[model samples]
Target: MTEAATRRVPGAPCWVSLIVHGLSATQDFYSQLFGWEFRPGPEQLGPYVRALLHGKEVAGIGQLPPDRHLPIAWTTYFATKDADVTAEAIRSCGGTVAVGPIVAGSAGRMALASDPGGAVFGVWQAAEHLGTALAGTPGTPVWNELVTRETASVAKFYQAVFGFETEAVVSADFDYQTLHLRGRPVAALHGVGHGLPRDRGPHWMTYFQVADTDEAAARVTGLGGRVLHAPRDTPSGRLATVADPEGAVFTVVRPPED
Candidate 1:
């Protein structure tokens, strides 16, 4: 397990959350898959629960209103020193702040925004909740990345909004860039061009760490989730892309053993 964060870092991926229609079923699927336990969270927005691993907060799952038609997907939230400032920066940088920099009780101030490419994300000014409490272990988020049609304009947007320094992959065939803050890589951007999913559009993808990628992929299938990509070895580790039964897509990875 990763060390608990004592403070939030501006522009870093601080949390990930999912909104689904069937909260109980979704919780059960994740509980069996990742050994998570759920606890009630602030209900200022809706029925929500914080997922915990060994009593440490790992992620969040919330229920959508019956009349709401928003897509069921995992949203990545970036930490900010000030949500209002971040929201204004997003707007001035050609991104759209679709939701408020409003307070969720005393948990935090939050706003939902989309980059120029229409990839949705959240900016959070934390208060009582300090975002994800544990990571880098099974059932916890390991990475957050934006898979979009192109990286240039969106990368500029992020940099202008969050002051991220970027490092591009020196490759002829690949279009990838890593966004960094304070000399540490925080998140990544990939240009998939026309290969972007028609149904999903441009969106952030969350990666959850697992002990075994192949086994996790199989478990996803057994739990009624779909494996969008079969487990494959990469320089980073073995990984698979998958979607929950509700169609929220994420990746599962097992890093190379030390």
Candidate 2:
């Protein structure tokens, strides 16, 4: 495991959380799939809980609020120096602040927003919690990708807000860009110009590292989750897209052995 002993750099993806209707079911499925351990969160936070890998925080699970209708999905939050400042910047960049620049107990300050392309994400200014404590290992988050049709606009919007260096990959059929922080890739933008299912819309997909993509994908189905895409080898690793039983999509990738 690669222990992240310090806070993630600003503008990098810091954390991810799934909003689900069945918290216990979600916990059980993930624990069986990824060997995660759960820690109960504050009562005021509803059924929110943190998922840990080998004693280090990796992700979270929260019960969907009954008051407002929301889809069961994973939200990826980027690290920011200040949530209030980032919220203002999001507005200035033509995005909408859906939730708040509010305190999440003593954990951190957070705000939910949708990019101009309507891809929802969050920003976290860590305090007592410094986001995920490990990466580049099995059961830890390794990458995040935003899929959208508005490639140019979305790229411009993020560059304006985060000062991200957008590097467009020259390709014939794929319109892709990598968001770099100080020359290091932090996240990716995949433009679904065509060939994707018509029902697909803009969203952020979180990728968790696994030891074996095929085995993890098999466990997903065994645990009642659906595999949206079968495992395929890529330059980065072997990856497959899968959704929890409630339909929150995420990716599992087995990175090439170092």
lDDT of each: 0.93, 0.89
CA lDDT, candidate 1, residue 191: 95
Clashes of 2: 0
lDDT (Cα, tens digit) per residue for candidate 2, span 21-116: 888999999999999999986455678999999899999899987785686778999999999999999999899999998888889888889998
> TM-score: which candidate is best?
1
Model 2, residue 185: C-alpha shift (Å): 0.6
Give the distance in Å from residue 148's predicted Cα in candidate 1 to where it truly belongs: 0.5
What C-alpha root-mean-square deviation, in Å, does candidate 2 show against the real structure?
A: 1.3
lDDT of 1 at 235: 77
Q: What is candidate 1's TM-score against the reference?
A: 0.98
Q: Which stretches of candidate 1 lie over 4 Å from their true place?
A: none
lDDT of 1 by residue, 110-180 (tens): 99999988999999899999999987789999999999998988999999888899999989889999999
